[model samples]
Target: MSSIIYTLPEGFTTGTDDTLIYFYTNDRPSEKNKVVFTKNMLCLLQNGIKVVHTANGKEIVTNEEVLMLASGSILMSEQTVANKYEAILIFFGNKTLSDFCAKRRLSFNEKSPSKSIFKVPQDSFLKNFCLSLKLLKEQGNSEMNEVKIQEVLNYISTTSPDIFNRFVGQALAGKSDIKIKQVVGLNLHNGLTTEELAFLCDMSVSTFKRHFAALYNMPPQKYFLQQKMDQAKLLLSLQKRPSEIYAELGYENLSAFSNEFKKHFGLSPKQFQTENGPGEKAFGLPEQQFFKDVPATL
Candidate 1:
């Protein structure tokens, strides 16, 4: 998927499955990876800490914390020393949520987090439930794995109504309000298609473009390109080679990347590097102050 930042191992459920479990362990610490949550996700950081940055504020999730990320894009910065970093992630979509509510005859009408991300208050049962999920996964028992998902849901519904509502409440509320600022700010560095971005914002492509232009006074594509160019200039200033940064900017080939850079700054990538070198000002539009003032909450 366009949103995948890391290729998780095979024990996790497929997208089509009603429930999913993700187990991640890395012996070598990796550079921070940005990812877009394609579905509503529940994450339990079992070991090591994770720092998540969004258009809003940054959140630090530790083993004692449980994080709930709405269906949206987010920049995840992972950190670990010599020790292995591990986490258990669970994903449930609208369909699975609908089935759960219908079967339990429960109500989920509360308003959800105004921002796309939030930390859920820890529950003792929830922690234990996560441990059981790990056990099921280790056994490779697909059937038991699904049951563990339901068990956690049932626990939340019965013992912790507030947490349950916060977890799936907004998702059950149906489509969210499409705020131009939130959508654009969150996806500035993201490599999502216009159509995918529209879907996340709960708007048709035409509507998204119309609203975007009205808000920013320029077409979305133009704004996106400008942002990318600004980032490229910053990377060049840091002495990063064009080859290393091109793919990160979503370009497929060096030739195309150079052409775009030349068009934007009147210099090819190599020529710009040769003149500006490292630690020198690379030519491009000055950083936009608007990004600095992005709202601290979504």
Candidate 2:
């Protein structure tokens, strides 16, 4: 299924750097919605179930738990039990987490796995904390939002040390190279724009381009086009028709894909296919075998 891209905080009615406390309520249930978190987030589900699908697996959160998600992409589905879904979403940046750790002198095990999502069980204290945030949002006391978020971080660190440490480690481990790799690998076949990819990686477009070049030795647009052309050639050699593979390669239509294929290989896809015939093995080996030797970073 085609996925919708959303960058939180930017999509909200707040500035990018501001820590936003948002009361989210919906009357409808949604399934498999793709969400790319540009900032670290804490989601306290009050009256619904949230299933987050990540590379590792799916995590389910309900009223009994809070979800702490690192900046990344996930397929999320929300279900309401009483014809309404509700949650409190808190968005903060890496700097906020770093400053919080510094102020508290918090130390975590370096060997802890840097997980993308942490499910924190909701207790009486957390339920009360959620209530306080909802009240603050209703009272329009946005000035204290950051302070309140920090207070919750402090509470988590004190009460659930392991989860807190893993969350912190995940935030700390989100380096430029790692984040770029993750975003690109997940979206390689999706044909997302540069700005969208940058947003997903939580970086500015220029910064994303710079890091992308360092890793791939070419600009992102060029690298992506080359990869698509290479894959198209392999598919055509396997007897897949141009019309059948264009959409799968992220092209909108046959004409656009054909034009690009010609530009890259100096021959239209049909002409190339006619000359090479089926099962010709374009890269000297089967497609699966050829991809096995490719670098993991790509």
Q: Give the best candidate by lDDT.
A: 2
- What TM-score, over all chains together, does every model reach? 0.50, 0.57
Over the stretch 184-253, how does candidate 1's per-residue lDDT look in tens digits? 6667767777888788777899988887776567888988898888788768766789999988887887
- For candidate 2, the clash count comes to 0
| Model 2 agreement with the true structure over 63-167: per-residue lDDT tens digits | 899899988888989999889999989888876775566556576544537357798888999999988887877887878887898889999899999899888
Q: Relative to the unseen true structure, what is the C-alpha lDDT of residue 65 in candidate 2, on a scale of 0 to 100?
A: 93
Q: Looking at candidate 1, what is the lDDT of residue 272?
A: 76
The per-prediction tally of clashing pairs is 0, 0
- For candidate 1, the TM-score is 0.50
- For model 1, the stretches where C-alpha displacement exceeds 4 angstroms are 1-15, 30-32, 110-112, 121-124, 175-298
